[model samples]
Target chain A: MHTAGVTLQQVAQQAGVSLATASRVLHGSGSRTVGEELRRRVEAAAQELRYVSNAPAQALARATSDVVGLIVHDVADPYFGAIAAGAMRAAREQRLMVMIAATFREPGLELEYLRSLRAQRARAVILAGSGTADADATARLAEEIAGFEADGGRVVCVGERGPDLDTVVMANRGGGGLAARGLWDLGHRRIGVVSGPAELLTVRHRLDGARRALRSLGAPLAPDAVTVGDFTREGGRVAAVRLLRARPDLTAVLVLNDVMAAGALAGLRDDLGLAVPDRVSVVGFDDVPFAADLRPALSTVRLPLEAAGEAAVRLLLEPSGDEPRRVALAAELVLRDSTATTVG
Target chain B: MHTAGVTLQQVAQQAGVSLATASRVLHGSGSRTVGEELRRRVEAAAQELRYVSNAPAQALARATSDVVGLIVHDVADPYFGAIAAGAMRAAREQRLMVMIAATFREPGLELEYLRSLRAQRARAVILAGSGTADADATARLAEEIAGFEADGGRVVCVGERGPDLDTVVMANRGGGGLAARGLWDLGHRRIGVVSGPAELLTVRHRLDGARRALRSLGAPLAPDAVTVGDFTREGGRVAAVRLLRARPDLTAVLVLNDVMAAGALAGLRDDLGLAVPDRVSVVGFDDVPFAADLRPALSTVRLPLEAAGEAAVRLLLEPSGDEPRRVALAAELVLRDSTATTVG
Candidate 1:
């Protein structure tokens, strides 16, 4: 007898079936292949014996649970929402339940969630967000990932890279450079940037790339023209207002992400009374779905956010050896009516 | 010896402490009140014995899991996204992990997800979406929820009412009536309706209420005026195009939700070259965050979606008797630039 006081072999004998057939019936699998009569008989035998399968025990024996743990910075943001949809699609295909936790961009909360996921013995843990520049937090996260892997758990990151872990890296730098070059080529010399939080590696990398492009075009970016916010729509609006106030001569503005860009556009038009592409051109990154529907349509860089999410899950499910796998997605600039030649 | 080969008494004896102290330290609770020296001694004793706490076994003993399960129609939609954020906040306060599953508006998938959540032994399950009109699907869901409750699980529905289950009901009918009357007061005699999937109870209720209000104003709604889609932006766009093509003489349009309203506005301006509130007035339900940011500013009925989500969680966590609890939230109309006096 097992811990539940009834063994599979005994149930099979009582049901006049083989152990494999009884196991299949009890596990709720291979129902189509087995005869209905036999299946009913096995189920009845198990019921008569008061058999109850302990799921956590079974999971412990297999060293894995059916749950896939996903950590995101915030689910309210459209960018994360799109990525989560793609990840959930992949998870559904694999018949896995997803346990999601939002950190709200707090590095400490991210680490805490990792520990909780590890304790739950999740099949895989996917960290979906930009990496924090804090050294202590990074070290703590690396340690947690290493410990999880040592216990035979898989870890994959989307849009973030960690030490010796698989990652789906979005082309934030290249996308930023493309946006800068697109605006500069349009005779936009005096441009402002609506940047997200300065501590995020994503914000830093994109800003650095944009600055590099500006220098290459003989238009050095003014240090005072860069305004920072929380990477939200409201943040974009606030930053845009600050930028306009600091430099009214600016002919164009580049937002870090499409959401913030939407805010910047609204601020420019509603608050500043500026006509898009006529008085002040606007460029954004990450061509979200609504970008094309916005008034005048937003010109932005397209990042394969959904595809990257899928790739992260795929990497987590695939077998791995010593070295970690890496997948880098490209970002392209999509021109729309939001950008045009600077008015003389 | 217990299942793990060591007992709390053994650790207590090894640490030269009381059994309660050892139990508290081993469970990792009350550490703040317990002395540091005593806590370290108990931990060392546990380490020496290589003790591991079986969380699921303990949960089974207590007849509860630490995880909360949430089911949504679609997470990518901003409406659901906002609700999820509110639900997450409530769950966070209880230190519970949330397992989220999206059914994509599939009734079969909804039932299947509930079963999966039950198998995982979730503490509580929150179903957040409009109930389907399919009798068979609704009956199956009710049965599943009943079985879960019988097994000591809690079930709560948000914006959906199941047979004798706790529900957080949004005032869809009243909200729809308010929008219709608001338009009627503005002298909009001929108005088109962009409704969601006809199978959703929310759609039927809202449409019925709007038609009732229209009749009261002596402007009976034509059966052909209602166009249905999947409650999505693209669906709204298609429905708007069809509405315009079929009834070009209409003076106003009311969408079932803000997302579809945004789509209808885009279709009107981009495809039909119609100016909002000038050529034809527009109104939407569910004033999502971006509704006010849209060009011309959408006039919408505001539903406390996030608050409803929070209420659902609260209902699920509270103890209930044979009688189930119900919370109904009020919806109000917010006037904006999208609606105005009909042009001559």
Candidate 2:
């Protein structure tokens, strides 16, 4: 019956061909040859029967699959959306199916997904989520990656998963420096930072770079000037309010990411009733799609996020060398209407 | 040896258990039972050997997989991102892994992905992309869907795909009417529409509703007032510019989606030197995450995108009935600063 999936025997019988010939024409499993006319007959019969080869069975026989796994922290975040799009495009070019798994920024979920993807025998697993600051979690993730690799699956990390692994490193620290230097060059002395969770490597690197730049400028970021929040818009809004409430004299604020920067803009303009640039300047990082459309047109660091995603997939598909390969992408500053010269 | 994947025989030997016992303990296959102590030993042995159960093999034996496939028109679009996030959340609660595939709105790619998912033996498939207006393509998709169902897999369509399939229908027509009536009540008669490709079912239903409402109000949408473009920001920008150049007397514009609407706002404000609401009003649909954050705050129709995504997964998981089930979610109007009374 059709409910049980059409059998290859029926297709072969209908096409008046041998089972081996039908299998070769449809599944292309063995190195076998069939006449052109017979091949067409088998194909026509298979189409008539709506026959779909069992991929799982084929994978079991070959010990590999045509599926690639993309692991992200959150699917809803536009940051990940752009990256996933690039990765999927590259995957399509290779005629491989990309299966995305979102971790929701939970370390446990990330590991669980890694294990699941490994067990599913995905040919390659792209870890696009940021690395965690927790040492134990990092070690466990490294172990999982090792297990995946040991099982003949390739692993590509987007943002510093660990040492000795194929990675596409984004210039997070350099972007942070650029944001701080840009604000400092505009003559803003008293500045605060809206930071995401301290456990994320992205947050740490960005904050560290900004701190170094400000220190070099002879105005170290004060301990009280940094307010940590979730890596979300609401988090940015709330943190901006708290930072400003505590440091009312601060002339500018640097948000760790664009989404938070958007919230910071709303917080400064709507919640605090302050005029942007004239009273308080705001800078964001990772110029996302809507960054240019915000009220003041967010001035942030431009990271070629989509390109980085494409690069990750490329590295994964490339031949593995004795040592893991590294591809670093640069981040540049984008000046928009969001930042301006400070006024007394 | 590890690259070849740890074998069940090795694990059984390490655990001092029989092959059948190890298979049941690790893969949960067959009805054979093992003692509690022996089960723990087998699990520990498998962990020690780093043995990952071959999912493809297990799926072949069980005739299903724990993986569910989600097909979308585009992964980078925030509208789909929101829905995917909701579906993933619901899937996690049910202990199922979700594999998302983006078609990039290509009819051929959509059909190809459906076939691929079916070949992978995905337990269920959630078709989140909008149906096309092409009858031949629709028929092919329907035939492929029937093949998948015949293989004992579940199918859930997020939008109006076909009759006799579980569908979560959004109030596209009603929302279109609401958008038109809302603009009409503001005394805007010469309204232009920045529409997406007319081949899309979503575009047709929304336009149909708007036209019906306008006709009843004694003011039908002029054919010359509609400018169709790609379902993207640039498309909206170019469409808005073209529409306005042709009919400079128009005071309001209706954009099909928020991303394009964002572009329309820029096209009108920056390119055309028109102030939002003051010079011309704009209305958008979908009310994506950044709609409220956009400059001037977009006024649009709000669809329960995430909830709809969750509903699709729920429907797929539920026991199939003799007849297909339908779930319709309502869309409401959200008035923001983007719209105002028309200036005569």
Candidate 3:
């Protein structure tokens, strides 16, 4: 700060402005209360004088608890890790520390993390909904956020939305529909679906989109067309095994996430002796780094997870709740070598 | 805590012991204060009453932020996430919050995190060294730890140890030596080394073992035998390209980590058109989860990363001296499909 060689008083003198005006302009936090013309004049003076803010004061004022909390199902999965990186970047920008806890897809852990976040007095909690078999998770998400709010805690739910809570989510349903439509357009009549935790809102929404897409193509999905998994590789294998067995004639599958896609790929090629794309086209969600590197590069949806994390931070720090509404960001499809036109 | 259904006071009174002993037994903090006979009585009563400790009293006594600070390179890396999980379990046992920060391998951001830890008044700061290129990051690490201590902060470092601080690290060199021995015993010669950042202690140790193994075998390793990469998939690709191009006659390649191993697999199979185990054998470090799932399972060394993280937490919680002794955890080499009897 001293290295700037120009002080606030110098800026005030340079612009023929008052010391208070210069202080307000040079320091952004206080500038909000200053008049526009006076603020501009003070800023011009500071620019002319090459003035710098005091590091000690700036740091002290900006220094928060430095703790941001992330609630997730499993930290071991690469998809969660990718989202965590985004949250980390956001925390770094806000000069905040991050604490991540794995619920292991347990609703109990989700509640435990929320309570701990309250006790630690974290700046915000980003909840990636639990991957589980319970149908009430989405219905309960609002109540969960409400309880946290009652305890004077801030909640930012990613991939889920609830009343009175800040939510940053990807447009998952649209992405799912897009994936289904992409395959449907390729003349595939029998398309199978692999889904995440049956109870999760994302899983439900994605299934809805897939079913809708099938309906649009004049071919409604069968009751047994979709099989649910717990979002782990093992789960993917189990789901794929059953799906393939039930419908050996199925030509394409849209797996819930890329990790599951990897599992599906291995299960098909190695376990079942089926060739990718040629026999069964496989597509996945969440274009994790390894997706492109997989043997027949996986086709997947790239969720802007980092941006969602950043948006959550922005929302938490500058909450504009006069008319708070949920924001839905889009997830784009990234096509690679995973999908090939199917032939009967 | 409320759901325990048994009260500490009742358990103490029933066991004919004082409240402190029962509390200590229940909390598992401050070693067993009750004597053998008395401890037995307390345990018997506690079991009879199914007693549990409330969070309030513990929060009051150890209330001034019982948080263990963790700063790592990437949350997306499965190894670090495993480490974080282990550390969190330890923290939960001790009833503490684990504050985390991801540095993205930026020293400037790391400094900011270190300062943030101090400002937040964390109980201990645990730094998990992330990248390999940081040879002297420890020197810089020491300065930050010193500054935190000067500000009355406690720091415990994992993975990387230094002259000035308390540390918990895995035996990288020993593990590396064993890996080389594994390959040697398997009759593989003319081995190639693909290591992490050459400046890292782990990389240096692994490289030394490879050299020693080759030299002791009475085989002079060609200078062209060693290649250094950034411990990334892309880095592996680039390094593999150069090494394979230079030495088409090489029999095997040793990779520093599993992520890089997957990349080396791609480069050999897809880019370089070489058959694994037949043309060149590949081995990696960390034995991450995905290693076993890859087409040809990876051969790797398993390091107890989680234990290291927990050990660091332990050291940080307790005031240890400046002796700076290394805690050498045991590691084993896991052999799988990636290596064969050097079929020529």
lDDT of each: 0.83, 0.90, 0.73
Model 2's CAPRI class? Answer: medium
Question: Lowest-lDDT window of 10 residues in candidate 1 chain A?
Answer: A1-10
In order of TM-score, best first, we have: 2, 1, 3
lDDT of 3 by residue, A12-66 (tens): 8888888877777766564268788887888887766545443323322443233
Worst 10 residues of 1 chain B by lDDT: B1-10
lDDT of 1 at A141: 90
Q: Which number leads on lDDT?
A: 2
Clashing pairs in 2: none
Candidate number with greatest DockQ: 2
Alpha-carbon runs more than 4 Å astray in model 2: A1-3, A7-21, A27-38, B1-3, B27-33, B342-344
- 2 against 3, candidate with superior TM-score: 2
Q: Report the error of model 2 at residue B312, Å.
A: 0.5
- Chain B TM-score, candidates in order: 0.88, 0.94, 0.79
Provide the DockQ value for model 2. Answer: 0.63
> Model 2: iRMSD?
2.4
Clashing pairs in 1: none
Q: Using DockQ as the measure, what is the rank order of every candidate, best first?
A: 2, 1, 3
